[model samples]
Each structure stands twice: as structure tokens, then as C-alpha cells.
Target: MIMTKPRIAIAGASGFIGIYAIEELSKNFRIRALCRNLPTTNSLNSDVQWFSCDLFNLKEAEIAFQDCDYILYLIHSMTKGSRLTQSTFDDLDLIIADNVRRSALKNNIKHIIYLGGIIPEINYGISRHLKSRNEVEIVLTCSGIPLTCIRAGIIIGSGGSSFQIVYRLVKTLKIMTTPKWTKSLSQPVDVNDVIQFIKLCVGNKEVYNKVIDIHGTELISYNELIIKIATLMKLKRTLITLPFFNLGLSKLWLYIITGIDYYTISPLIDSLKYDLKANHSLYFNNYIPNPISLNDSLQRAIENEEKNEIKPRRKTFEENKVRTVQRLNLPMGWDSIRLGKEYINWLPKVFFTIIRSKVNNNIVRFTFLKINLLTFEFSDDRSSTDRQLFYIKGGLLVIKKDYPPARFEFRISPHEQSAIAAIHDYYPSLPWPIYRIFQASFHKMVMYLFNKHLIKIQNKKV
Candidate 1:
């Protein structure tokens, strides 16, 4: 009994989950990747084909899904803007769903598999990210296509946005001032299991027109998840929940601390107010025989992250020539000499002047001051760096050359107060003034001589 591989088309094939899904399904399926960017790796099996097509464009989407048996819709627009509003999220969902439905109908695609959020309720406290997921599910269900929607909670994986945030926060913080939503329950699933579920849904007649809730074996609170992560990393953490902490304010705080965009964090924090625990009774009765444990999933995720760290990161032409001077000890009052022209008097004064520069061209033209701290030393070859350390801890970006890295320990200072005023004057839209000030302080200026320079520093050895 010889079985032939099904021809499957994956939209948003370049995304985190999409890439993982491709890796899992590529061996058993003839894949057609529909993405905005062309596939970078030539290592894809010969059975895979790529089409550079924007999913928002209905015409292009139609062409992309042509002759495909199954269509996987795994796209979202959280990173496109500063705020993920409910209206904006809904609009994107409607647009994607309509376009996908039309394309599927035109191409006679047999089935459509959509990955969406598990949260049923939506509110101001709920993140725009989760609301968007809910909207996408509605659109797919209403569409004429036989849609299989897999509603999943936080997916715990190495490179996933949610997991990355938790991993970094847990690894870095010792005393955590978390919000009330830390007690909210969520059932996170493994990335591997998510891919498996998607693969199983492909052309499965029994599950073709069903909405399944998928999750890991454990139902734990955000605080518990943090504790588990800290335990895994062998770090001691003391958790303190602030009763009056504003959710939106907390998101802004997290953005400053984690270097994760506020737009993404806003929605994630909103979703934490509700219980995202998945009811796996249906899944157990219908889908697989068993699901993986949270411990095992976390272990795999860490391994994957370690592997990713060692993997060679590909950079653009502009990124390659950009030199990163590690822990360069710049003396106080260090002046910039650019092509024999003196740009500024000293490092601190120059930084202050750079912040005051109101001109847009002036902002992006010269080299910006960039500061980062080496936080976790995994090995002699590998170490973790946090770019937003100063900002997160309410420390101002001080102007000093030859400042030792050890002097920049996470703390709050009076200079942080002055930094806020400077940041607000320059970048008004930045939510937390104090945080932005810290970010701007440890700045790196790339001289115009290397305008198109791109540099990648590899700390991990394969």
C-alpha cells in the first residue's frame, strides 16, 4: 500500500510557527510556501516550492493557493504597528479570512487549517493580540471553506514570542513585581505538539470541519509558569504581586524591561486577565492518544533555543558591515572624530545633543549610541545580553566614556529622573519616559562611513 504525499500550501510560511510547521511537515508533504519574502534556505527538499505573494492581496493569494490540497493560514500583524487595537486586529482578521476563503474556493483547496487563540472573552483588559485571534476564528468559521481551527493557549517553544519573554524575564529577574493577572490560569502547549496537531488535521476527514482546543498537560498560573522557568534555569526568584498596578502600565514596564515591543506586550497582558485553560476532553477523545508534559516541553524548548543560538544567523548586506565593538571602554568626554570632522565634544554631551536633535534625518543619519549588558554566561563561547537593562531598572543612560560594564548593574537612580525628560522631548510617543531614557543613554553611533554596514556577533560555537 503505497501512499503519496499531499500537495500543501502554507501562508505566512516565514513566521516562527510556520517555519516550525514546515520543518515538521516538509518530509511527508509536497509544500508550496506563500510568503512575502522568498525562501532563504536552498536546503528545502525538492518537493517544496515557494511563491512570493502577499496574503492581503486577494489576487496574489488566489494564485498562491492554486492546485493545493490543504491551506495553512498562520499569519498575523502584531509587529506592524505600535498598538494592537481591537479594531485593527479585527480588520486584519476579516481581511485574511475573506482573502483565504476566496482563494481557497477559487483554487478548490480541500481544507483550511487555522491556528488561533483559545480565549473566548474579549475586553479592554484583553490584549489586541488575543482579540485578533478570536476574530480570525469567527471569520474562518463563517467562511464557506471547511476550516479546522486549532485554538491554542501560550505555545511554549524556544523561539516563540511568549516563551522568549518568559525565558528572559525569569532568567534575569530575582525579585518580580508582577500584576494581578499572574494568578490567571493558562495551559501552554509544546511547539512540537502544535505542529503535530496541524499535520494531523491535514486532509483528516474526521477533523476537517472541527474546532479543537489544544494544550499541554499542565494548567498553571502565569506566576507558576515564571517559577517553573526560574527553577529550570536554577535561579531563585521572589514573586510579589502588586494589587494596584495598571495593566497597560505594566505592559509598558515589561516592554522597557524586556526590549519586547509594547504593541505585542499590550495584547499579551490583556489576555492574562482571563482563564485560557484548554478543555482537552474532546482532544483526547478524538485526536491523539496522549499529550506531552510541561516539563518535557520546556526541556525541548530550551534545547531548541540552545541549538538556534549555535546556528549561523543570516544577515542582510547592510547588516554585515556594521561593526559591533564589544565592551569598548570609552573614556569620559570622549569626542567623535568622523572622517577628520569633530562631531561632538564628549560622549555625554554628544548623547544629550543627539537626544535633542528634532530633525528626522538627523536622527537616523549618524551612528546611534547602543548599549547592551552581557547577562547570562552559558559557556566561554556563549553569553546572553540584555539591551534594555538600564531602561528596565529605571536607570538613566549616563554620558561617560571608559565606563566599566560592572558599574551598570540594574538599579534606580536620580539620573533616571532627568533621563525621562530628555526622552519625552525627543520621542514623545514612547509610553514610559523613564524607560526610553535608559535605552537612549547606552547608545552607539555608527559613523556615516558605514551607512550600509551589517554586523552579526556570534557568541555560540557549533
Candidate 2:
């Protein structure tokens, strides 16, 4: 009798490690790509089957994991903007692990492999990202499925999120003054080596039910990593470390300078204060006799990035236009506030009047309010022509047409009705009382309605 190839499902298959894992495993195992978004069939091998399901949803996860022998859980929320804090990491990790484990149990998956971070001892206060990874591993271990957790240091590959941060910073800055943490130790691994270890774990029962640490041989400081990258790119760089700099502040500065965003860089910078060195004896004993070196790994990543051979095909606005529109069109309730005697009146009719949908998901809502005589501005000696016209959705409100063009633009969350208000009221001169009162009451009400309505929509979908 001939043995058949084992079927495998890879959640987060669209990510850095997951994509490479699929490529590496496709030749051997029957591969199933499980992700929130449908995998673009354009680049994937025809043998792989693509399934779309949100990992957090139990029913959706069940359908995605059905009939698979092995699962690769590589999902994380680093791409979710500013909200990717420690709490978000914990919530998302718990939810995803619970759903995936339950589904794995039902489908009788033989093994689960997770890719996680390797932190330094000094910085062991669970960062949102690290805590989340640790929590998921805990959930997986107790799930009854044999599990292999590969905790790795900073992945040094082009196109990977961590690498992109270091890459862009080194490329953009000529002289860098950074926090003291820049001198912290890290063992950066090549993406390909990480992928190779993941692939090797497929049928290796000895490695099952184990947490393995993987890293390149060299342990270098982050500043050294930057210098190496600068040397590779042939860019001149000078570095100075300030004693009192905060990671949070540094993250904001990096985001502004490099365009990588604060949420993505914060956890990385925070974790950098510790030594991330790992014991490689176990890896050598179980896996390849000689793993790829740091230089070889870096070279390969640079070459691949140059060749544009990475997965997920960085989406252009034209490609995402439809999805963007769909998200905008998703129904969200509206609230209108009309200027009043003592305070503004919060009512639906006032908020939704004269709403205009502009190009590229921009929306504007206009409302005209009658000036109340008892209002402070009306009590002033000025003539009674006082009327307030509020322009919202992009956070533009014109109390006076003669006011200069909007200095800042804002967008309302698709499922939330509240437009950020104080930006307009503070310009020219600050109106502290007016701004404070309107913002607190109106903003709170809008968020309340928006969340209430969003919950209803999600429940209805179920």
C-alpha cells in the first residue's frame, strides 16, 4: 500500500512566515491556505486550496481547519494600527487560539506549529505582543494537540515587518540619535532559516510537544544591526544615544521619520533592551546539520526583496478600492448636534443632514443651527446674524466661512458615527470651554451609538 501525503492547513498563510511555509510545504504536503482574506491565486501553486475565514470566529475556524493533519498558526495584529497594544495582543491571541484549537480538536489535527518571539531576560515584563504569543502557546499546549512552538529572535529578511523597520530607518536616517536601548542585544535570524525549521518540523515527532528556540549564531546589538545594514547599503550613519529617551517617544519619532507606524515599532524597540540569544544545540541536533549563516540570510532577503518575490503582492489603492468602498458603505448610525441655549442637542436629524460622499471614501455632513440668544456668543454685543454651520465626517466645521482652509483632516470610523471635533474649534484661538463641552458629550454619544450599532450588525451576521 502506498502512503498519501499529509494534509496541512496554515492559518495566517498570507503573512511573512506563513507564506514561505506554504511555498516550502506545497511540494510535499497537500496544502490548505487559511486566512481572513482569500489568498490571491495568481502566485500560489495550483495544488494548494485557499479558504477564507476570520480566525477569531469559531464557526469560521472550524470550516477552515476541517480535514487537515497539521496547522501553522502565524496570525498577529501588528498591522492593525495604533490599537496593537498589549491588551489587543492578549485578546486577539486568546480568541484565535481558542477557536483554532477547538477546530483542530474536532478535525483531529495531529500537530500545531506556532512562530513566536524570543525575549531578553531584562525586558521580561510581558509586552502586549510577547504576552499575546505566550498566551497562545499556553492555550495550544493545553489543547490536546501535539504542539511545536518555535520562538525566534528578530527575523532579518526583506519585506518582513521587523526587517522593514530596521531597513527603512537605516536607509532614511543619515545620523541617528536614539534611546539607550539601541545598544541592547538581539540574535537576528534569516527568514529562510526560520522557514526551513518550520518545514523540517512537519513529520518530526521528537520535536513535537516542545518549545524550541531558533536564531542565527551571531549576537549583535541593534545599533550594530543598523550599522551593518547601512554598510550593506553603503550609506553613512552617525549614532548617539540619549539617556532619558522613552521607547514610546522613540517609537513616535521613528514612525514620523520612517513611515513604519508606532504600533509596529513600539514592541520591537521595547523588546530590544534584553539579550535575545538562544541555545542552538537543540536545533542542530534535531534539524539541519548546518543552518544558514547571518550574512547568507541577509543576502538572500535583500536579493528576494530586490526581485520582488515576496508574497501577498503589496496591494495598490486601485486593487483595494472595492473593499474600501464596501467598508464605507457598511451602515453606521449618525448623530447631529445643533447649537443650543445652554448646550448642544444630540439628535439623529441634526447629524445626518446634507451628507455628501466625496471621492475615495471621504464624507461630509452639513448642518445649520439657529443661534440661541441665551448662548454666550449671542449675548455679546454683535448683531443677531449668528448661525453655526457644522461640516463633519472629515472634521471640518465652519463657524465662519471666512475661516482658513482646514489645517487637519479626520475620518470617522466606518462603524462609528462620531467625527473628531476639537481640531476645528482650537484653530485661530483656543475655545477651551466650548471645545471641551462639545467634545466630551458629543464624542461619547457618537462612540456609544456606533459600538451599539456595530454589535447589532455582527450579531445579525451570525
Candidate 3:
């Protein structure tokens, strides 16, 4: 009998850990990347396939993970912008995880491997963050698939959230006043070791339905880890711990100094109230024998960051709202044709729209040929661009790239004689749950059309 490499679907392939997981796992498994957006072809393995998907939607998830036997569950909303509060994030994580569970079962997926937090042994000191992580595990296993949970503490590696937090704190501070929580014990694991352990679990019956503990070579407090990292970087740093600095103060310090979002870091700080040393973890030695040491992992983490090997794991809400403005000058003004009346009229004659219908308004609309009508509404934005209006999209902060052109009716001197054209984009901010996966080339197409229109107006050759 010819044996086939089990097809594995990665639900969050665009994330930092997810991308690295794909790169390492591709050699052994047939890879399928399911993400909110399509990645560039060159970034994927030749045999790898991509499915644009939104996990919150079960229909999309079913299609994305179809025909795959195993799932590498790397989705987490701790840093996701849509997750406003820790409570909100916990609810959202449960919803998304449950959706994945249902979809995985629908697709007949057999096993799921999850990377989650290591909970504190004491039930009384359990945090909302830890509870959320536990809930995800519960939801994943409720679907009846064997869920392999790899509980990790602070992960020390380049591009990792936990590592980045420590790096920023150490790199930015010379003399620091840290909070009381810094003294808590933490066992951090290397990114490479984490990846290797995940690789070892594939097709392993021993790891099924198991909760494994994976950490660094030794346990240390955050204070010691900071000092070690500082020594490695050859920096002189002084640390004074104060119990009075509460979570609010710590959150503010991280926000103001490190420039990381305080909302995301706040809950994590809350969870750090207790020690995060792993206990009773099913020994990973069942598969892989060697684990990377903290010194080597810390050194490699810095080297990777310095070498620019780190890529962004997740996007803040602001990244989704891409805005672009292109300006054009009509050296010779329109004589007979006023504004784009002629151009607008000319579009229907040549432009290929999927539908032959449109709504009549102040803003002219051109719909693209797609499953959904991608309509570009061109209206005047009250500027030298022969436009006088900009409408705000649903809760999106509309940014006009250039300040509404500084116009002075009271002439200090003769203004330059030219018709200025400007473009504006208001991308609506949709909640992550219902977001539909679509091609990203729409932005580039807008620019291409804008430049082409300028050339045409200049009476230049094609």
C-alpha cells in the first residue's frame, strides 16, 4: 500500500508562529494555509495550497480545511485589535475556537494540536487570561477530536509576543522601576524548540489527548531574565522593584515607553500575578530528547531580530484601514468637459462591470467584476481636486493623506495656475468575526487607474 503524507491545515498561517510552523512542517506534511488574506506565492512551499478564509464563519472554514486530516491550531486573539477588553477577548476566543471545532468536525479532521498558556496550579489565583486559554482547550476537545495541548509559559524568541515584551522593557530602560510581579517565576521556551516539539507530535499516538508542558532548560524570575538579557546585550541597567506600582501604572509605563498597545499588555500583566513554571507536563522526551537552553535561545532571539528575520505576527486594527491618496495636475484645464463628466460617461462604454446597473447620485459608481460588486464611488471632496465632499465610512477614521489643500481666497500673492486632483480612500472597519476574505490587489488597482487617468488627461501617449 502506498502511504500518503497526511495533509495538515494551519488555521492561522499568517501569524508569526504559524508561518514558521508551515516552513518547518512542509517537508513532512502536505501543507494548506488558511488565512484572512492570501499570501504571496513565493512565500509558500511549491506543494502548499492557500485558502482565503475567515475562521469565524463556519462555511468558509469548512471549505478551507476540507480534505485535511490534521489541524495546527495557532489562532489566538490576545493581540487582536478587535479584542477590546480581556473579557471581550475571552468571549471572542471561545467563539472562534468553537467555530474551528465545529468546522474541523465537519471536515472530518482527526487531531488538533494547540499552543496555549500554562495555567497556575492554584485554582484560587486563576486569571481571566488563563481561564480563557483553558476554555479554548475545552471547546477544542468538546468536538470529540483528540486535542493535543502544548502549554507554554513566556516564549523567548524573536517576533514572539512574550519575548518582545521583555525585549522592549529591557532595551528601553537604563534605570527601571518595575512592579512587584517581576519577581514571579517564569519558564520560557525557544521558538525553534517549540517548533521541533510540534513536528515530533505528528502521527504520534502517544501525544493524543495529552496536555504537555514545554519550557526552557531552567526556571527563572522575570527580574533574572531581564538581567541576563541586558548582560547579553552588554547594557548597564539598574532595577528597583516597587510593590506600589499597580497594574495601571505598569500598563501606562509599557504604553508610554515601549509604544506597544496597553490594552493587549494589561491582561497579560494581570495573568502574571503568579508563577508560570510548568508542572506535571507529560514529558516531551516521549518524542524529542533535546530542548534548547535559555542562553542559546535568548542569544538566537536577538540575532534573529538583528538579522531582520522577524515578521509581524498579527495586525492592529489600524493596519486593516489602508488609505491612499494620489494627486494629479492638469497642466491645461478641461475646456469643454467639466471634471470627469466625460471620463465618467466614457467608463460605461469601455469598462467591464459584472452588472449593467448602478445607482444615480452625486457620487458616480463603477462596479468591478467580482462575486461581490466592488463599487468605487468617485465624489468631489471639496478641494482643488474639483471635489468637495468626503463621507465617513462605518466608524472608520477617514484620513485624507494630504491636508485639504491649503486654499486662501484672500490672495497674498498669485497662486500657482494648475488644477489639482486628489484621491481618498475610506476603508470600513468590520468586526473580525464576519470579515470576508478577498483579494488585496484592489488597492493597487485604484493607484493604477489614478496614474493612468493622469496620463490620459495630459494627452500623453499610451
Among the numbered candidates, top lDDT falls to 3
Off by over 4 Å in 3: 1-3, 80-87, 309-462
Candidate 1 lDDT over residue span 1-462, tens digit each: 978788899888877798888888887898888787785666447877878886645557888888789989887765432211112444444555656876788788888899888865434556667766866766566556788888888998877878877876786688999989888888888888889888888888777677788888889999999999888777899999998887877888787667666656776777778888676438533565567889888878877776776232222222111111111211222222221112222223445644321113212112234322211111211111211111111112223222222111111111111000001001212334443344333332322112112111111211
Give the Cα-based TM-score of candidate 3 against the true structure: 0.67
Highest TM-score: give the candidate number.
3
For candidate 2, what is the lDDT? 0.61
| Residue range with the least summed lDDT across 10 consecutive positions in model 3 | 405-414
Q: For residues 1-462, write the lDDT of model 3, one tens digit per residue.
A: 978888999878887688788889988998898887786665536757777886744447778888898999888766553222212556556556866887788889988999888888885758778887887898788788888999888887777767777777788789999899999998888888888899888767778999998877888998898899999989888999999989778878877776656656877888877898888565575554667888999998887876884443343464333322222343355421244454445445545543333436643344545222323333333322333333322112223323332111100001222222222223334443333223224434543564466567676632
Candidates 1 and 3: which is better by lDDT?
3
lDDT of each: 0.59, 0.61, 0.66
TM-score of each: 0.64, 0.65, 0.67
Clashes of 1: 22
Off by over 4 Å in 2: 81-87, 122-124, 309-462
Candidate 2: worst-modelled 10 consecutive residues by lDDT: 320-329
- Of the pair 2 and 3, which is ahead by lDDT? 3
